[model samples]
Target: MNRKKSLQIFIQSPDLHQIRHESVTGDQTLADLKRSLFPESNHRSSFYFTLHGKPLPDDTPLSIPQIAPLSTLVLQSRLRGGGGDGGATGAESRDCYLKMYSEKKPDKVDPNEQRLSKWQNCALSNEPLREPCVIDKLGNIFNKEALVEALLGKKLPKEFGYIKGLKDMITIRLSSVPRAEDGAKFQCPISGLELNGKYRFFALRNCGHVLSAKALKEVRSSSCLVCHEDYGEEDKVVINGNEDEVAALRERMEMEKTRVREGKKNKKVKGESLEGSRLSGTKHVMAAVEKASAKVEVNGKVSNGGGAAKRFKAIDVAPAHATKEVYASIFTSSRKSDFKETYSCRSLPLGRN
Candidate 1:
């Protein structure tokens, strides 16, 4: 067995229940850790690790790597790669030059000349010019896919992977389709590809795609993905009549979902509702038995707490030949709503309702 060292495995899932132990051995590789964390579940590959805020690829080489020690590992799925290798279209080249020269040029450099210098570097990349990994105004990493999606309002990939990171927030791919101006076509903000409703959403591990509505339904009643609170309902307000109608339908479905959730909740409320019902029927069989045996109350008699004392009753059971019949009688009537008052009196044999 590996030395018993304490290691903290931080999963990206916002669900507290989802995070768990790896195996009995506990000491595991980055790869083994990922696998053990989700044995039967899908989506195991897309996870990458970061130690102390520096992103590390899953395949990172570790020599005498620290294992089984709590060093703070966070699961992430951010895109991998750096910026610019020449090869830029005229528009991109101009933008890059202007951005570099006007905003970032050193004090000694002329902005126009700096723009020209920056443009030359982009012209060298042979690959059909890709977007430079620029930082957005918000300081967020700007890749081609995200920029495209932002420029066009819509999702990038109809089918894309998502993961919940350490802070209890979800991270989704930047490849969704953007809402096009024409209202008919959806283009990817990143790849600039056309998107359709048929696309599916998948796990970060590329498990598969799911429908947006279906996904929303599944997650609607859980803790808030952003705030991680008891509030799980969609908070957005409908802005138009058509939207209001759709919202009403969604609300109806949500009410049904809430009902089903409530049913499960009731099932787990207490044993009194279930076992107590059965015990009431069992009293019938015991009634006759008590009649045959002498009643004994050592100290105090059983009472219904109503200031009055009631005598205990018992059931009479026949010999082996009739035992099956007795059992059938008890089982069948056990589930009846009025089993206690109706068939409970031996003198009265009330049949099915």
Candidate 2:
């Protein structure tokens, strides 16, 4: 018996449209379903399908050899005629509002303002405020606590406030942070970046706001005066260490390295003949301790970044083996069998017929 390949596809869209269709044959194209999904529209090439919520070409081949079973299919249509071959320049013809303005004013007073005017009424009243700050060069010290506290009062989420500069005003400086005795995790308030150690700094992205650790301490609140959000020490997610703990760890590592280097130079001279001595012993001990402790530290990290979604649970079978029998067995059997049992047996005497 020849196996028939099939697929189960799920369709999703930004306009809140969702559909699920079982592909009975591998030869089926998305264009076939587009008709059922859209009856009145002859412009089949205009709308695009989003598989798993990501835009994909409609003519893309779904199945090979047209023989497979146990597949999942999702059919999604573009919202009210959006994606098309005309591209951005031709988009104006589709929107009546854009066409009206384009005809009314072939030229505008301010090009920037003209674009913004077209997008009127799209602004959100509850939009968040942003601040600017810059990082200094290395070896610079800043009061992170005070800076975060002041920024928190501005009603902006801690993640939005980041380092920025004017004419190279934004300088980044590295400083040590206190660590918890056991271990702890920290997240940068400005960038929402997570780090294992108590202290670390890096350049910020996608933000025009900038402030340094030192200047942030002097400020009482975020520059956005209307925002009155306040942050407390307790609001921070504390780990095993404070800034001091991190400082000590850094110092220890530094001292060990310095001693080892000195010992190596001394041994190279005619005065010291010993290769594996006190310095080597100390280095070995410290390395072992650091490794053991790090192994046990909490691995905290953000799961979602860059708007990527979690991976879908997938079967272990190969794409070619996913045929129609396999697809139906996975989903449709339960629904079909349930319906047959109830409907085929009759509707148990309706009250009024």
- For each of the candidates, the C-alpha root-mean-square deviation to the true structure, in angstroms, is 27.0, 40.3
Q: What local lDDT score does residue 16 receive in model 2, on the 0 to 100 scale? A: 41
Write one digit per residue (lDDT tens) for candidate 2, span 1-353: 11234343433333544333333445556666676667888877767654323344666555633312322233333445545776565333434543354368532233333222222111111111112223222111123332344444554333333322232123222222246232222334443333332233323222312223323344545341123344442111212234674455446546755898898887687344454476788898987765544432122333442233443222322255576456546755322442323545643334533
Q: What is the lDDT of candidate 1?
A: 0.38
lDDT of the candidates, in the order given: 0.38, 0.38
- Candidate 2 stretches with Cα past 4 Å from truth are 1-3, 16-18, 52-54, 64-353
TM-score of each: 0.19, 0.19
The C-alpha stretches of model 1 lying farther than 4 A from their native spots are: 1-193, 196-253, 265-271, 294-353
